[model samples]
Every structure is written in structure tokens, then in C-alpha cells.
Target: MQFEDVKNARDYIVYSQGMHSYSKAITKMMDLYLSYVPYVERAHQEGKKAIFCSALYPTTWEAPLLYALDTIPYATGEIGRLSDFRVMQIAEDYYQFPIETCSMVKCLVGQWHIRKDDPGAVKRILGVSSGCEPFNMAWETMKMQGFDVHNPDVIYRAKGVDGERLENLIKFFIRQLYRTIEWVSGSREFDEEKLRLEIQRKNRLLEKMRKVLELRLKRPYYIRSLPTILILNSGVANYFARPEEFEATLDLLIEELENIPVDEEENKKVIPLLWVGTTAQEFGIYEAIDQAGGALLGFRSSPNKLFREDVPPLEAIAYYLYDNQRAGAEIYMRRFLDEELGRINARGMILYGIIGCSYNSVEREMHRNYFHQKGIPSINLEGAFQLGGPTGQVLTRVKAFTEMLS
Candidate 1:
């Protein structure tokens, strides 16, 4: 259930039959969990500070900032709320945060309450960039409750592929990124050298992810191992704190993958299914797919855009800015699905529509329609966060879809 070292973790992965990529993906997560116990104990004993923010924001860069400021970064979005839905309900039931608000946003409210009286609780919250209405509202509510909330002011719209508009978008994003760092540093000046080193490490992690993605593109069996899910879970576990541990797992994974020769005949028999919509699996989407016998090519989400390592920090931030400029409408996602599904040779898709997410829910019919036209079948599964859809129904649909594709 828990491994203190990576070797034992690898053995656990080998033993877990239906876990697919999850067992390995979760190893670094466990390492991070073990680190958290020490992190909390240290913060309490040594009087260290922590900053809370959304994981949606690129907080990996803050590792250097944390070291410079003598603080730790807590992505409440990933750790605080996603760990338990009851934490989110606390905001709605007790705090009277609007019941209609996004569950993730409401969870932030509950996170604040949980930490409000803690000896090492953080007072400053780095607000979100993407203005999901409920998220902004939650930020505003936290400000009212005396937390220093900093929201990056920027327009959220897709700047077309390659142009001056995209460049400008990147410039604007870099400016906001610098401002965020400056604000986080406050009286304590930022250590440029430290940040550069931290970013280099972050870029290295991204490069490893890029390699994993590259391998998955050519080898469908890699999907069964859930490399993408492993990447996502690494973030969920706040692997940024101990990136090398995460990298070590990557090393083991890469070594293991290299040894297992790609079976051409076996690959031909497996159905390639592209997962669309928000990345789930705090509730077991990856395991479900494994049980259903479908090979997931990858997810169609912001995670797909791997960060660039070669460029200068500012330019890289610009590239990141442009890459992350998600359109509010479903058109961009539709285009991505059309392009990627074909590229990956995906036979079918599973679109997980979050229950209260207005944007994703409205696009379900259009998603089904477009895939139908392309002769690619897709099932839309609905749920709140990763709690997921009805298990029997979801697995049945997944099995049926795989059977049809096969």
C-alpha cells in the first residue's frame, strides 16, 4: 500500500495486475506523501511557511521560490480538494459558498477553513489565471475572509497557431509570471540563480514526459502501462518537492519499457482509445480502462502540451502561455479531438463530462455528433471530479466499445 523506496514500489507495480500504469504512476506520489509528513512536521517544528495555490497554475517554477523564501508551495487544488469530495461539500454546507459553484472552487474554500487555525497555515494564496467563474468567486470570497489573494489579470482566448498574436500572448503571460513571482517574494528578493536551477530541473521532468509521450505515440502497449496517468499522478502527489524521486521512477519505467519488446501482433489486436475531456482517476478511470481491455493513447487536455526546455525562460514562458491559452468554447477541443484521434489511430473515445462543468456538459452532444460523422464511436461519461460515473454502466460501455472497435 505504501513504499518507502522506489525499488519496493517497482515490485508493487509488477504485482498489481489490473493497475496498468497506475502502480508505477503512484510510486512518486507515495514518495511525495512520505515527504509531506516530514514537510508538515518540519513546518511545525522549524516554523517554515507554505503558499497555497491552484495546480492549474505552473507552480513547479516555485520550487526555487520556496527555497529562496524559506517556504513550501501547497497546490490546494490537487491535494486539498481532490483528495476528498467531503472537503468541497464543507464549503457549501458550512461556509455557505454558493452551492452552484464549481466543486473544485468550493473545495478551496474548505481548504482555507481547514488551515485557518493551523500553526503553519499560509495566509497568502496565489489566485488562478484561467477565470473559471466559480474559481474567481472563491478567490474573492477568500480575500473577503482576510487571505492575500493575487489573481493574474490576463485574457483567456486561443491565439491562433503561429503569429504575432501568439507572440504577444506569450509576452503578456511572461509579464504576469514575473509579477506573480515578485508578489510571492514580497520583501524577500527572488534568487534568480535558484529559480534558473529549479526551472532547469522542471524542464528535465518535462523532457522525460516528452520522451514517454513519444514512445506512446509509436507503441500502443505503453498506454496499458498508463505513462500519462503516471505523469498526472506525479503532479497530484506534489512531486515537484522531490522531483528526483519522480525522475528515478521515470528511469525505472523507461528501462522496463525498453526491455519489453513491442509485440507487433499483440499491438494489432488491442483497440486504441483516446480519452477526451478533463483528466480523471482520483477515482480510477485508468484502472477501469485496463479492466475493460482498452489501450488509452492519452488524454486530450492541457497536459498534452509538454513544456519546451531549449528556449530562454521568458521565451519559454511565452511558449507556455500560448500553449495554455485554452478557448472557453468547445471548438478548440473539437479540433484537437479531430486532429489527435486520427493521428493516434484511435478507434473510439471516452469523454468524461464533469457534472457541474457548464462548458464540458454543453459540448457532449456535439462531441458525439462529430465522432459519429467520422465513423469513430465515443461514449460520454458524466460525474463530479474523479468520483466517476456509475461503475457497472461505465465498464459495460467501455467493454462494448472495445469489443466493437476490436
Candidate 2:
């Protein structure tokens, strides 16, 4: 779709959803999603390989390797907006998957079923071997279906492990990275210069995002909650393909934020809040918060940190993959959450998770109890990752939570 078409879609979404403002950045993000499949098709035509990934994997861990090998990256998480529910239903019905399966897995499987016969679609998947059973099983199903699937052995953090154990884990992860690279590129060695360039590009993007995040603290929120969530989602997933377009979009967003004037009356009504846990797929949650006079100041799913420049690019990525609290120990996750809440000066939090996501279900409660003990109010909400939007019950809880915060 063209830029104007994307802009019109964004406007319709905002108006239909009863959201507060329009965002050029969010429009560009929609454009990128629209452009993705065509880009992959063209890349395949030009003899470039394509690899599929889930949003569960850190983009930092995979983007550089893909770029160095000149491969196009397509993520199941990045496909479609409102149509995700239809795709997800196809997976559930066709595969006879249980209703309790993670929605993302069903969505991925559904996408696979729909595109399995498409010659230009990616058949090679980079899968994760650890964390989230449903996700792992989805990859296994794809492998059985004749797709070329490679699951890199990755482990979650263990308690009381440090020093030698930690070193060994990092080293093992680095080896897996190499194995994945070799599998995708058909070569044991990748161009270091290309990897370094991708690293530099990523760093530049992070710096820009940091500024946008800082700007989010401003009252009357020049950028709305949904746009910010979308941006952070892209940040965590590293855009994977054509990241430059995303970077340019950020520039426009930053400029707009810088020039926009804060509404003093709205600033007085704004109740700054934090969102913690799985990404909120429902657009209505943000609108509910807006309706309840809450401004989302920050969001955390993964640790908010940058890759190190002092170390080799690969080593830096490996370290981030190993240490980031997204998949790390409870202590690290708690520490990260506490620091982020304090940094954004959040008055309250929204702890969200997908239905049937055991991993996040446990996490949501842990975070709720932790924040409760700290005298910070938080409400936990669980819902499907469906496209039509959250149920009225979910929306009521979100609005009530934000209203209480206000």
C-alpha cells in the first residue's frame, strides 16, 4: 500500500477506536507491514534466501546474522493487523489445536497453512528450543509438515548461577548463534564488516528510540500509547527487514514530538502509567486508557538496554541475548521492572498477558504481587490475541484500572 493509503487507514483506526490523535510514525509502521510480503517475494525472485522468525526471539540475536548473509527476514508476528484472528482460527480448526494453545502459535501455524503452497514464501524457520512450550511445539509441527526448521538450543536463566556457569551459558549461546548463521548462509564464516554495519545501524536506531521514550515522559503525551507500544514492539523485534524505513519514520515522529505543544488542560488530567508483561495486541486497551485519563509513560517486555560497542559485535549480541531480563532470572526481571517504573515515574501499572500463556500468566502474578508489596497499584488482565479487539470485560478492567490511577 502507498503512504497515503496507510495514512488513511491510520486515521480510520484512530477515529473508529476513539483514540486521541494521529501518528505519522504509526502510519509508517503500518506501511512496513503492508510492504513486507511483497518485499520477501521480490527478494526471493532476486535469489536471496528468506528466514522466518517469531517475535519471541530477540531481533538483536538474529538481525545482524541475516543482514550479513543478505537474507530477507519474515516474522510470523509481523503479519497482518485485523486479519490475524481469521488466520489464527484457520490454525485452530485445521490443526485441531486445543483452545488453550498460545494465540501466537495458532497464528503462526495458520499463516504457514495459508502460505505453504506460495512459491515465494519462506520455508526455512529459525526456531527457539526453549521457553514457552506452545511456541516450541508450533515449530515442531512445522518441521513435521516438511518445512526446514532449525531450533537453536537456548536455555532460561537458572537461580544462583554466576561466574563460571554464566560464562559457559554465554559461550554456549554464541555457539548456537554460529550454528544458526551457518545453517542459514551455508557458510561457517560471515562477513564481519557487514555484521558490524548492521550493529551500527541498530545502535543508531536505539539512540533515536531512547529519545522518543524520554519524550514520552512529557505531559499531554505528543505520542499516544498505541504508537509507542508499536514502536517498542518494532524495537524489540529489530524490524528485521528494511530497518532504514523504520528509522526514517522515527525521525519524523521525533521532529513532530519536538515541535508539538503540550496541552496544559490535558496535562493536568494525565495520569502517567506503565504497561508491563506481554505485548497488548488489542487496540482498545490504549483507547480505554485514554478514555480513563491515563497516559502510558512506559512499556516493558524486554530489558531496556543497548548492545555494547566496546566488544566484538557477535559477543555484544550474545551477551545481550543471555543477560536481558526478557528471558533471564526472576531477580533480574524484578530489578529491570523496578528501575523502569521509577525511571518513567509511573503512578500505576497494567500487567497484561495472553490467555493460555503459562509463562506470562505466572509472570503477571509475580509482577502484581511485587508491585503490590511496593504499594504500587497494578491490575492484571488476560485476553486472546484476536483482531476484533479486547472483550468488554477486558476493556472495563483496563478503564477501571486507569480511572483508579487517575
Candidate 3:
């Protein structure tokens, strides 16, 4: 059921407020779905089993098999997009968490509370143990609400801090991800060689699809929803672990989207920024930014359409596996960054990092320094979906930056 009217409220909160507000914002948004006190019946209802995890971590990791047995295990926004306000209010009203907690947490707790009533409201809640506090806080909060929030121990088992270690970490996560999920789902683990072949296959499809993004960025005037290229990258990468299926989807999506002449450009002002927050769907910040003359160029993170062409059960060989093999979250963002910085002509960037996400925070620093040194007008404005901007403090920074560019 498509709830067109049910615009992802949690997303709006995060977008509007920032990552600090997600805990409360997400809960508040989910509040609208109930036929009870808060949420009146709406038409557009998305019934997929959703799980929220760190984009960087999720791409390079996987939830255990138990989550896959019931969940459509996946990560949420790149940043500041998924906030549960009502739930945060609930948590705040009761617990009085300090100002340091990321809004994503309160929102997750609030949502879990609701899910307890509707098992299908959300079956699985996977939290990443990225930073010190959030890892412990998230599980404790969920346990308080009685929800099975799975935390994957994706420790980078390699030595050194060089890119090789990073690469090793990526391989490590991908290798064990599915086996973990399989174990969770009461199924036998996949052979390592088979999973390795799957990663190679998906990587090839990623290579092809990235070409389309290159074309679109090089010529945005012809592409409609150019951001879809990034979104599709996430979708296709995650859905099909095999090469043939990944290619089929990439070929079709690219052929259809890339075919549209590159003669058009999105008209929103604000110099059109792709809100790169880790959990970005909380407060319609992108929409508000667009309202303030900026196009929220959507996510280059884990999208759902990048791999819809070869519908899973249709293309892969009889023995193909697609459950918790997280293949897409690997290299999409790096590619998207290279592509969008060229096309979106972003004025400045926002970090939208949760208070304690080590991987995302590190990625944000890398993104900021890269763009800042390039002199492309960027800022690593930190805020959760629930916290900042109560007084337009962030907008003040953004306003200054916008003026400097103008």
C-alpha cells in the first residue's frame, strides 16, 4: 500500500532539525500511523519490514540471521533524516536523557515502543556499535522497550590504519555478514568462495551503473531526478549479491533514466545541496532547504531503486542468496561524492553526523576537508535530528555561508 499522504514524517523531522532530534522525531512520526491516539488512518502505508543502521557500517557489515528471518534488514538515512519526535518526547518526558545523546536513539526507542504493539510495525531494529556510548545506549533503550535490536560486532579484524586496513575491514564485514544473517535465520552459512564471487558480481554492476552517474553529472541538463542514480546504486547493490542480477537491474535503470536527455536542471535555489547526514529524514530539512532555495539532492547512500530491474527471485541462479549479504553499502557513497560534487554544484556541505558515530564522523571529516580544500563551499555543521536549530542556530551558519558564496 502506497501512502502518498504519509510522507515519511520521521524523515521530515530529521531533515528539518538535524540528527540530534531523531530519537524523538522518529517516534513522533510513527505516532501518526496508529489508528489510536496520535496517528489517524492515512492512505499511503509502506509495509516493508525496516531496520535502521549506520550507512557506512551497514554497507560494510550485516545484521545477524535472526533479523533476516523477519526483517527486510537495511539501514536508514545517510544522516539527520529519520527522527522520531513523539517517541523522543516520550523518552524525554520519562527518562531525562542528557543533551549528548543522538536523536536517533530516542527515536529508535520511541518507535520500538510502538512496534511492540504491531509486530509488523517494525520487526527488526539493528543498531551499530560504532561509538562508545551509542552502542550501549541503543541496545539498552531497545531492551527497555522489549524490542530485539540486533547489533552486529563488525570489528575490523585487520592490522594498520592504512587504506589497506580499511579495505580489509570492508572485506571482513562482507565476508561474515551473510553467514551471520544465515545463522540468525536458522539456515546454513554460505560458503566463503560463493560470497566472494557474489561481491565481485555486484562490484561489476556497480561499475556499470556508476558510468551512468558519470554521464548524468557530466550532463545534468538531460537527466531527471539525477539523484536517483545515487539512490539506485544503493538499492541494486544491496538487493542482488550475484553479478548477473545486479547487472540486469543496473542496465535497465540506467538505460531508462540515463536515456532522458541531459538538458534539464532542478530549479530549487539554495545552490542545491545533497543533505549528506547519516540519519537525514527527520524533519524535512531538505524540503525546508529547498523552500529556502536548495534542492535536497537526496541520498547517495543505500537507496531502494538502484536494483529493481532483475527482481531477486527472478534472475539469480536456483541457488542464489540475497538475504543479509550487504553488498551495496560498500562503495556507493565514494562514487556518489565524486559524481555529485561535479553535477549538483553544491554550495556547502553538512555533516549531519550523530554525536558519537565514529565511522560516519570520520567520513564526514574526510568529506568536509576534501571539499573545503577544493574550495567548493562546504561546512560540517553538526546537529541531530532532534536537537539543533531550536533557534535557527544552524541556519545562521548556513546563512553566513550562503552569503559568503553569493
Best TM-score among the predictions, by candidate number: 2
| Highest lDDT model number | 2
Better of 2 and 3 by TM-score: 2
Q: What is the C-alpha local distance difference test score of each model?
A: 0.59, 0.71, 0.44
Candidate 3 residue-wise lDDT at 322: 25
Question: How does each model score on TM-score?
Answer: 0.78, 0.88, 0.56
Error of 2 at 160 (Å): 4.0
Q: lDDT tens string, model 2, 105-164?
A: 787788787777777677888877874778777887888887899888988767766789
Q: Is candidate 1 or candidate 3 better by TM-score?
A: 1
Regions more than 4 Å wrong, model 1: 1-49, 56-72, 80-85, 158-168, 187-189, 217-227, 233-240, 302-312, 324-330, 363-365, 386-391
> For residues 131-203, what per-residue lDDT tens digits would candidate 3 score against the true structure?
3575477577666766666665555232234466555554555445544455445465434444344444444
Specify the poorest-scoring 10-residue window by lDDT in model 1.
2-11
Question: What is the descending lDDT order?
Answer: 2, 1, 3
**lDDT (10s digit) by residue, model 1, range 104-147:** 56666777777666756667787655757777777787888788
Stretch of 10 with least lDDT, candidate 2 = 1-10
